[model samples]
Structure formats: C-alpha cells, structure tokens
Target: MTSFAPDSIVLNRKLPLWYQVSQSLRASILGRSPQDPLRLPTEEQLAGHYGVSVLTMRQALKELEDEGLITRHRRRGTFIEPGVQRGAPVRLLGSVDAIVAQQSGMVAKLLEHGSSPVSGELAEYFADVDEVATYHRLRADERTGEPTNHARNYVRPELAERIGLDDLARWPMTKVLRDLVGVRIGRITDTVEARLADPETARLLQVPLLSPILHYTGVTYDEDGQVLDVAVIHYRGDRFSFTVTLDAD
Candidate 1:
C-alpha cells in the first residue's frame, strides 16, 4: 500500500464543501486494495486536509456511513467497510502508468466506431479540425462482466486512420497510442466532476437515469505539446473509485 497524505485533498468552492469532501473520502475508501488496512485517518486529521471544521468533516463522513461505505468505532477510529473494497473497481489516477496498469485488467466492448464533428470545446484537441474519428466504448471487469466505464474517444485525423475497432477492443487508447502509433505522450490532463447521468449515459452504463456519475474529460498531449486525443468517460458512481497519489518531492 502507498502512503496517503491527509493534506492532499483540494476542495471545489463551487459545490457544497461537505459534498465534495465526502466524495473524496468515498473515493479513498473504495480505492483501497484488498490487502490494504481498513483503518482511515481520524476526523481531525481529515478535517485538516480540506481546511474544514470538525463539524463539517463529521457531516461529510456521515454521508459515507449512511451509504454503508465506512464504519466508525469509538477509540478504534473510522474504517472502510470490510466488503466495500471488494465490491467496486478501483482506478488509480495521477499518472499515465498507473492508469494503463489498471485499465489492462478491463475488457473494452466496442459500441460504435465512426466519424463525428467535434464539439467547439473539443476542436482545440484536433487542431481545429471539425470532424474526427470517434469511438464509443464500454469497459468492464473481465471476470465479473460488470461495466465500470463508458467512454467516447475523439482521435486526431491522421492518428485516427491507423486505429480501428480491433485495436481499441484489445488495448486501452493510451496503450494503442504508445505501442501502435509510436507517439510519445508528454502530458495527460484530467478533469473530473460529479453529475446526474443523462438518459443516454444511463442507458450505456446500465444505471438509472438521473443517478450520480463521475464524469471525466482527459486530454493527451504529444511530446511537442500537440494534442493527440481527447477522451470523455462516464463512470458509475457506485461501481468506480479513483485513487490519486501525490509526491512530496
């Protein structure tokens, strides 16, 4: 198990502080490996991370307890539920290598492959190209067949030509880009948000409409800082968790 820094949490002032804090803690718990210890940081330690008062931190933790995500014992500290770590898929963020390693265990189910006009916001990734190759894919745990992520990928035109459905089904997009296209990825940027699933997203992920989901938009940049691809993924809130690591060096 890796060290978890209590002061690493960053809150978004745009949403309720408690809601954001709860989600972060939930991710930490769900992301725990089976071999990892169940005990979590104390309330005071956790509160210090987000710069929140003890009462606010307690409220955030209460949310987890109500969801059966964690258990609290006096003098024993808070601990993740015994079974929670085994129930959901945990994806590590913060590094390309970590993401690739986690993704290798999942199988990609190709939903659709075709060309589509990029959104205005996405055009920047394609060097202002209006249309690009698009792939709709669903990733599931290979053993359990449980869907974890639904993703739409928009590839730069020339790069897209070399990639086909077969490539995506067998390898993660990052792997395909690195091993097949032979492109060196210099940077990866990811933004995550929690939102209610729309009808289309709900259908693809097999979750109820309006259910909470984790939305991620990730961009891959080449060695020269050129954008190579953009991926938009929807992860089932209950089925997925993210572990992000920070280095102090």
Candidate 2:
C-alpha cells in the first residue's frame, strides 16, 4: 500500500505532454519500485493513480517496453527485467602508447601546433590559477604510417615555453614532458563514448561523416594529482574494440 507522491514524476524536457506523462510513469516503475516485480498496474490503474489519460499512460509504458525495461504478454502483463550487476578489474591502467607498444610498434606524428588562452573547461581541468598564459595544443595522428587514432593534446604554456615544435615532431611528447619539464607522470583517466563522426573527425580518420567512432578522452595527472595534459582521441570503430578483463569478485 505504498502511496505515489506528486513530486515523484519526472517530466521529459524534449517530449510532448503525453510523452512527458509516460516518462514519469516509467520512472516510477523502473527507478523507484524496481524490486516489486508484480507491482505493474494496468493502464487504467496507472492513469487514475498518476492523474494522466489512459492513452498517455499506455504510451509511457510502451516506451519502457521499447527500452527493454519491461515485457508484456497476453495475460501475464508487464514485468520488470531482472537487474544484472557486474564487476571489472581495477588495476588496468596505462597510456595508449604503452598499451599498443606491448602489441606492436607505432609512430606518432605531430600535425598542428598552437597556443590559446585556457577556456573555462580547460582551466577547471588544469586547476589554472589567475590569468594563466596560453597552453600549447598539438594535434597528432598515431599509426603505422596510416590513420589509426586521431589525438589532440594540451600542455601548460610555461612548462613547454622553451620547447620547439620540431622536437615533438621527432619524439614522443611524454619524453619531452618528463625530460624537459621534469614532471612525473601519475595516473590517467580514460573515458570512452560512441558517437557518429562529424566532418572534421571523419576527414582526420579518413572515414565518412556518418560513420560511427569511439571517442576517447584521456586526462593525465602529475605526481600531485594536478592535470598535466588532456587528450581527445577518435578511433575507427571498425578497427578498434576495447576489451577489459573483469574480476568475478
């Protein structure tokens, strides 16, 4: 006999009134009462309970079914899918070069080099204090003389002020950061997302604009956990699939 509260429904920002109403009802079923396998009420029951039209309630339930959150049968009615939880290895950490070097050798190319004032996003990421100088941004492609992964990296200006752009074209930037700047590498945070390739990204990766690609954003930190560099890499979806080993425990 749990009571539904007025504030429990969340309206979808992009949808119409009926869709918003449906989203709210779906949220109640999937988010709040997920453990109650047999609690799915009929369309009329939900309409009266949520103060929405029967059609709107049905539309919301349909969306949930489309998302594979619930299933319906002739007489059995809709039921929540059992939750599945999994764990993965926590110790897997390394740079892209280090990981690839273990498998095969690859070359890094320095394509574009420039500097600009740190934006709000970059400032927050770098913990830049005061009016920080422009940061050196480099766009490079890593491969075996062919397009593999398109990468863009940003480095603090002061630390890389004396370094020549030609030096990066000849050597790995990690070496330059360690040997010249005297910054010790700490840890890197890597995030992967699936996205359709834009014109610029497609041109760099030698693929069509509508092609799918995996966007990898990596943030490198120094010994004090201060961000040293941020890299956005685009990898060809057909050629790359990341496999992470997980712990059963």
Candidate 3:
C-alpha cells in the first residue's frame, strides 16, 4: 500500500477548507501505483484524519471524481483512475527546486527580445544596480498546442548583449545566470499574486479578456546579496497552480 506523506499535506487558510483538502488528496493520487485496486480511506476516516466533517470530506472526494481522478462504485470503495498518473504535466514551485519540467514537450516561441533601462517599480528590486535591461519574452505551449505560460525575463545591462533570443529559447534562465553571467546562486524568492488579464496578456496566454490569471514574480540573488535575474511569469489560472510548503515557527 502507498502510504500518504502526512507532512507533505497542509491546508491553505486562504481558500475554502474543502478545496484545500481536495488539492492535498490530488497530489497523492498522482503518484504511480501498481496495486490491483488502490483503496482510499473511508470518508469518515479521512474526515477524522483531517479534523473536518464527513460532509467536507465528501465534497473533496466529489472534486476528485469530477476530475476523473477517482471513482466510486455502488458497493466497491473509491479507487484512483487507471491512467490519470500520466496526465498533463503538473507544475511545482519551490525555493530550491525552482522549475522542474518532467519534459519540455512545451515549445517556446519568442515574441520580443530587447534591452531597455529599468525604471519605476523594478528599480526597487535591483537596488543600487547601475542599469537593468529586458532580456527575453516568450510564450510556451504544450505538445497538444495549448498555451501554458508566458514569461518576461530581465537581466543586468552588462549581460544584455551576451544573452540573446536563441539562448532564451534553448534553456532556462538559471543556466544563463550560471554560465553567461557567472553567478553562483545562493537563494531565490518568489511572490505570487492574482490579477485580471489585460489585452496583451490575454493574447499571449490565450485566455479570455479580463480572465483570472496568476502573476508570479521571482528574484534570484547570489551569496553576496546581489540580484542576478528577475522573472515575471504568468500562468492560466485554470490550467495551472502552485504548491507552497510552510513550516511552523
């Protein structure tokens, strides 16, 4: 039997308790399994485990069933759908892990690559830096030709000329930061916010005008506290999500 990793699941207070529980359960279901009939804990048992009502647990299970990740028979218990483990790639975010793509079936299409002096709100992020410039802009799509994400990347002015569009299309910015700029990564900070898609953002992401979007901004800094790169990536709210792990003080 596959044991659940209790420590890996935490409920987010920002969302409804049922939604949070459903997401937690969904992660466990994604792991590959070879058991003939995978068995999930009873609704009452799960409710007791999570300290929520059985009604809340049923709601969470309903979400999984609606997504075709689980099935409930009249007499037989719930089981994970046979082939769901191989579904669309799930995006996971972490401080050290960064972006881990199982595979790059998603093709990158460069839109515009140019350089301009940083201004306004961006100036605060790279404080005391002489000059910053835009390095790359691209949108990515899945093998099925669905838009996945749109990203705008920036780097120090000194590296603007060295890092070109081809480089952006080939590999991730982390590689460019290490090879081109010669900076040993120390830490990464990520901030996620919700926003409404604008005209340009809508076109790039293929989302409806004014649709909900996830705005993610990350800043990479070296050991000396110097900012190395700044990235602003947008993900479709429906097709993508992020997982964050927090430890209690």
Candidate 3, residues 1-249, lDDT tens digits: the string is 554332133444545667667655664454323443467777877888777799998998997898777898867777777654222423443322224222122456777766666777688777777567775455454325667677777777766766656656645576567655567777778788889998988998788999998888878888988887888877777766666654352
lDDT ranking, best first: 1, 3, 2
Candidate 3 global CA lDDT score: 0.64
Estimate TM-scores for all models: 0.62, 0.51, 0.59
How accurate locally is residue 210 in candidate 2, as Cα lDDT from 0 to 100? 77
CA-lDDT, candidates in order: 0.73, 0.55, 0.64
For model 2, how does the per-residue alpha-carbon lDDT over 1-249 read when each residue is reduced to its tens digit? 554332233333333445555444443432343234444666677677767788877777786676565677867666655541111111122332232221122234566666666778777786654333232322332222445566677776666675666655433455456555677777678788889988887887788887988777767778889877776767777666665433343
* Residue 207 error, candidate 2, Å: 0.5
Candidate ranking under TM-score, highest first, comes to 1, 3, 2
Ten-residue stretch with the least lDDT total in model 3: 96-105
1-249 per-residue lDDT for model 1 (tens digits): 554442144454545677667756664554444567777878998888779999999998897798777899999888877754223443443445434544554668999888888778886677567788888999876557778788888888889777766878756798689767889888789887889999998887789999999898889899899988888899889876665644353
Measured with C-alpha atoms, the lDDT of residue 72 in candidate 2 is 73
lDDT of 2 at 232: 72
For residue 237, model 3's alpha carbon misses the true position, in angstroms, by 1.0
Off by over 4 Å in 1: 1-93
Query: Distance (Å) between predicted and true CA of 177, model 1?
Result: 0.5
- In Å, residue 91's CA in model 2 sits off its true spot by 12
